[model samples]
Target: MTEATVAIALGTRPEIIKLSPVIRECERRDINYELIHTGQHYSDNLDQVFFDQLELPDPDHHLQVGSKSHGKQTGEMIAGIEDILLDVEPEVLLVQGDTNSVLAGAIAASKLDVALGHVEAGLRSFDREMPEETNRVLTDHVGDYLFAPTETSADYLRDEGIDDKRIHVTGNTVVDAVGRHRELAAEKSSVLDDLGVAVGEFALLTAHRAENVDERDRFAELLTGVARAASSLDLDVVYPIHPRAESRLNEFDLDVPDRIHLVEPQEYLDFLELERTARLIFTDSGGVQEEACILGVPCVTLRENTERPETVDVGANRLVGTDPQTIHDGALAMTNSTTDWENPFGDGTASEQIMATLRQTHSVRTIQ
Candidate 1:
């Protein structure tokens, strides 16, 4: 077997979406990279569909860690990933975003001889309350390479006393993914027609963060607020509900408002189509916020704060906490706002830049 020169670790839909560009760049350059999937957030809809829709190659190793307590899950991932690293003996390991898989990969690679690269590094919600904040902070400190997505993120790393030499602002791969796939989504996705929603007529919603959905009252308030806002604008909310949030609704016996249309989790192209065509988007996801901004759609973030504050600074998104009245007002405010805000994320070349940086720093085998 050919020894892999680089290893990329990821375990969630967002990671898959954000890293697809990098994977494609690797393929385009004929880099010998092994893909390791931790299976941290695996489901056919959430996992397989993304790989299928994005035309990504299958992972070389899958550690079926599944769901567990944070410590248990991450610990299992570390052991499994370390074993793979030992066998593959890659020079560098790459992880993206602030998932448990990322943290585990960082810890595993840090312990081994491999250099660790954290993509979308230095993002801080600053809310220690968020598990992701802890994951990102720890991963950034241990990583040998910090590929920050924006200057704001780079500054955050500098403030944290990290060496500026290790930080490189490589725009965001989401912009690359969106640019690469939006046209494909438009041509291939019939989601709007299947959902019976017209272009520029419906609102898209996605709230699945533990902070938002684990609590019955908070989840109810979030849903109610979005429903009220959509109803006031005479628009139907098409929610591609996350499994966790859907389970909460059932467990809480929460009543979904008539104006809210709940659908199963959608494939990548379909979700991108929904975001591209929606008049507005309400989300608790950081990726969706960035995607909305990149796609030139107005967004109202369901959370009180965001790591991607550039979206707010550029008038692309509003960070309104889950209050029915406040959400309604925020929706109204964004509806009246223009979608012409400049994309704070970089032009669609982040993938190319990331690959070039890797080649410059590491002695990876590349096809001539």
Candidate 2:
């Protein structure tokens, strides 16, 4: 607490969203920190929207690495991060979630002998085929402080040979951000008005997994399923299309149906508001699934499986897969199902819990 002593490393939108709550926590508690953005996603659309929507301070450094093969991109980030880290010389380098950016930053810090803190440390899809799974596992091994988002995540670390003393069940900061921003969502979102959606009268739809978008027919099938579900229920559906999904729609000649309002990508605040009013939501995003569960909206996951089984266990979500009939039936069942259930991700004190871990791990360590 003697000086601002943490550096946050991020690149993409998910890292931005998950880390924003941690940055805000530092600010609130008078913790000094520097934010470093590795430009793995350099598009202003991909990265800037999050900074603007979250109202984060301009990053102290941006690598501007842009797009490349994952190995090349991550290597570029490691070199750039090492340079900046050498200059700022913080007590701990903080990386969030499981992106190549986080992986690169952790590698940079480990080589430099800097203490490392990882936010959202223990999520796993058990699919090493995913670039993210590798990132998550590697980061956990090197982190001096690991802030796991759930007890499930903490248990994952324990099973993986992580010392229990180094891992803390801090809950997910997504819940912290959602809890903090719910009122702003109510005040700023016009999504409900634009779609003529009354309270509890609509479903929110989103689907952009690589499997759904990278394949032409699969992408069309996703939209088609949502369209069918919206029509069957006679409910207005608001879908804020992701760019990947939009590009595939054009490639596949998919139609945006009358009942399905294909809106622009929403900011974090508006997206939370949309989740709040949605009768049921459909998506393949793990973060959105967690958000919807925490916001008291029943969610139909548009994928074969979810990494966040805790939400399903708590009765807040169901995996509906890509079949149109399944999407429709799942949405209908969610609409009819009870939403009054406990949020297993804790009561939004993740930031405080994380700070406690950092305090215990940090001392007069040698500066980088």
Candidate 3:
């Protein structure tokens, strides 16, 4: 244990949740690691609360880079990150999932000769139209170690000419987070009671994909479909409203109905509690797809395709494109389906597995 182990970077809420387990791993193993936050999200709900709730150390460094066009935002982060790399110069750079920040971090590290380990690597929708697909592919290509969340995602990497030895099928970290938080959620959460929804009496719906949110008709249609679907079941539809989606909701003059409860997005612990008790879930998010699967709740994905094909492969989720009939029918079907899914993601030890790989790859550890 001569050299300090790694430098890890993340910018969004998902990154925080996924990386929390690994940070714990670093502490347990006495591995020295630096956490860098890029300030990409810049929302109290999305970023700040995640840090405080997860007890993630105040980032060793923060860029405070506000939002910008995709290219400029990413380029600015790349330059700033490269400067930081020049300073800490740790043995490995650990990054999470597909986002501009992760892509920028990978680019900076690769150009500077830093070894990169991509957590939540190898996921693909195979649609270049999706920004995430590009981010995942490019990041995996540069990563020295790749942690795949499912067999399907691993196969995707192998097909793309990734080094077979570099990829490991460690399960999704959302599942890890779910397992780590369930009891605490049950013990601490009152979302269900506050919403006045009995156990297993509601469908949790969350949709804020940029593709759907930007088009007024598309946005109106999505809410209309949810209103129709949830109303049909006589089930409560609890939407922890996303701010971006809220703006769109207003711009489209879409009045969120009484049945469709629009509320502030809950923090990690509360959201997981809602997921645990939810009868079903509808989302345009990759992370929610994985979370519902881990909790054994049926999911209707509003997106056309999912990167986590394991959910579809296991019959735990159904993809319904933004068409109103398709979305309505998918949600209705999910209400009746009683399928139980064994989590494809590993057994809540992805962080430990990631650290084990880091140790093997970099050969170093020190607390400070």
Candidate 4:
């Protein structure tokens, strides 16, 4: 196979974390690739800190397309990516997860007849109301290669009429990321000590979904539940507030309980260490759910449905809606339960498998 020029498009902290291993693999093999940042998450905490901590190469191109309404944001991203795709003409375009960036990259690549690879593909929350669901579904359909994270995700693609030959079950890259950074996180992060919390003594909490935080009532219920659960367990809760959620809390005039400490977002290493050491986790973020499960920390999801059903199936997580009572009960149960449940996401070689498959399947082209 000849060498291929690849382009990876990503935005947001989770995408960077999950795609780090793949980027490193490209570097190690001396592959010609360009990293493009959509600026979907342009904040220092949400974006720049991750690259510094994960040691990823600086993005070759940054669109600086900050947050906007879904239609506008996605359209802008598609236009921005199309221009780059036209200029670079990479043999393949790779995108991960179900963000607007992923959807835009898929659309641009498909229109240009570039072979598109969708990592973390075929995850379905089955809730059309969720924007992420729509993005994942569309990207999966348009993709030339679907790198599913599990058998369940692969089955979802097959059911959607995607060719089996294009589907590869390469496990979640979260596993690869966690495996690579856990030890480094423990050594370097002092979030636990800084917060004055002992290992296995605090409950980590985070809620950032628009459905949960944009609505006053729902946000109130989630906050109440977190407080109730913390009070019941006699454990302090540490919440790294996402900017959106923080603004909503102020807009709604909702007050968090004293036991729930609201802090700014931590760097990747600090956040990873927090997840690894926490006694329990309550979150509305899918990436956090995966991280908690990978770290053997019991998780109570603040949403009614989850795309990562493997976490629930393996008994590592429970889905409790934003209802106060349900959230409280779910957290209580998870806190009291054992974390002996197996991790369904495979061992840390997912990046290796992804690169191998890409190399074998695509007609390699040079970087020039």
Candidate 5:
């Protein structure tokens, strides 16, 4: 790589997990880079613990721009990130996933004329109602290098008129992270014993998306459906509640069934252990869907559609929105479903490919 320095910006637990492989490769190859935390998902449990569990180096910069209204949060992040870009003057600004952090990083880098590279690019739920959908679309348009996770995602980028030269078909980094961490999780996590749940005996649940959890009716319907599934199967459902979802639960005064156990958020390793061992997984999380597919677990997605259509196409996932009966039926079917499908994500070398592309292509168009 000709550039003497580069910067990778991210915030939120999913970003940390997905980006860990890239960070490690940079370190291994002795590449000059800095990690910046936008602090979009700031909290000890949500953010800090991921770095510790993943063994990633602490960030060189922390904007500390905690959560707020969408516009306020993104505006603050753009300002914070612009200041850092001015000081660091990196050759390239790399960001992962569709979050406020990714959008802020892309906007700041583009405005500063620092080449932008987006990982996990080209994914689209096509639902403009989703804030993340807007973030992904904007980031992809601004990014000079789009590291798409699959041919399907790459096709999405092409259809949007992105040139082939700028889009690279690198597999999703989540596969790389899981390959590196799953064995370690098996060795380290006691979540199963701690929660008194055995392998293949329980269902894993997570609902954090605003479309599902922030709306009282949708949230109530999701829980009711999940409860019905648990009752029918006589299987315990373990849910590691997100703080935002927990607040909504209290606000709505919704009752959780005894079969569904609500627990505090687990550390990354613990959650990985749970995801690997659970009989079936039900989630509204994009990352979780990818993880479940990679682990060969059948998944019931609590959304009308997914950006990850490959999972559904491969029979590893089923999308059954928040309809109570539909959700229950999907869970029942997935519980009896086969986990024999292939993982459409990559073979775990995505980070290396990303770094290699940046080095071999010298894709950075501007350095001032």
Candidate 6:
């Protein structure tokens, strides 16, 4: 039997972290796979640090798309990816999450002979305002393989008319990532000491989503609410601010509360360590919601809605939005809640399942 060739395309830190397990699986099995990185996240803290910490191979193709208007960035990625797909012509092309990079890869592969596989499929915030919502919806429809992370997500795909044959309920890779990296993070990360905070003593904050940070009023409210919550809880708020959020904060001339300790973005292991040890976490990031749930940390989502509603259903998270009083109340409630909520993601084998499914399907296609 001929070795199946797989191409994995990713951009952004979350994609890198979520997809690292699959990349390692390919190496372990000695599968022929190409790593195509769309440089959607250009910052060293956001991009290179994850690859270094994850010990992933340098990308075979780096499309330096960087930051542009959504259309411009996706258009550039489509061109670059289409060129690579033509050259490598892999049997399957894999893209993870709802970034513009994922949409571009799906669009490129759909026009080619290669089968498209979307990892972390069928997530929906149902808010058309989010570009990610559009990306995920379009990618799921175009994908030949929809790797839904949970039954709820699988149901979302079913309701959208995706065939059951194509929808595989593989657990979310974030669960696998947290399980695989938790011990490593504990051993290597000194974020607690570096930040002068102890385990279970500080609340972690990550609010970078445009919906939360792009608007001056919203950004101010989110910061004020989180800081107030932290103050009420008698805990320091450690915010690892994203570059975009930092720019917006300065642009808006918003006053960060004295209690909110703003720091530069962290590497994956360091951030994972923080998440695992935090007393409570507040974030607008979908991936953070998943990680906090898997890590058994109480989370208060700063968004109005979440794609990962499973986190809320499992009692692992609360959607508090940016209202100061609500955020304070929600934070108090979550901080007092039990951290024993079962992880809704999976039992840490998503990568293996995803890879096995690809191999079996590719082989069947070959034989037919």
lDDT of 3 by residue, 1-368 (tens): 22335888888888888888888788888888888889888484467777877777888888888778899889989998888888887888889999898999999999986888899988888789988889999999988889988788889899999889999888777777878788888998787777788778888988888998888888777878877888887877899987788888878787775668887888888898888888889899999998898888899998888898888888889999788788889988877787776778888888888888777766666665
lDDT of each: 0.92, 0.83, 0.84, 0.90, 0.91, 0.91
Which candidate should be chosen as best, given lDDT against the real structure?
1
* Model 6 agreement with the true structure over 94-133: per-residue lDDT tens digits: 9999999999999999999999999999999999999999
The pairs that clash in candidate 1 are none
Instruction: Score every model by TM-score.
Output: 0.98, 0.92, 0.96, 0.97, 0.97, 0.97
TM-score leader:
1
TM-score of 1: 0.98
Quick one: how many clashes does candidate 3 have?
A: 1
The segments of candidate 5 whose C-alpha lies over 4 angstroms from its true place after superposition are 1-4, 363-368
- Model 4 ranges off by over 4 Å: 1-4, 42-46, 365-368
Better of 1 and 4 by TM-score: 1
RMSD over all Cα atoms, model 4: 2.1
Off by over 4 Å in 2: 1-4, 364-368
* Clash totals in order: 0, 1, 1, 2, 0, 0
Instruction: Name model 3 segments beyond 4 Å from true.
Output: 1-4
lDDT per residue as tens, model 1, 126-214: 99999999999999999998999999999999999999989989999999999999999999999988999999999999989988999
Q: Give residue 41's error in model 3 in angstroms.
A: 0.8
> In model 1, which runs have C-alpha deviations exceeding 4 angstroms?
none
After best superposition, candidate 4 residue 311: deviation in angstroms? Answer: 0.7
Off by over 4 Å in 6: 1-4, 44-46, 364-368
TM-score of 4: 0.97
> In model 4, how many backbone clashes occur?
2
Worst 10 residues of 5 by lDDT: 359-368
Model 4, C-alpha of 314: deviation from truth (Å): 0.8
The alpha-carbon lDDT assigned to residue 224 of candidate 4 equals 89
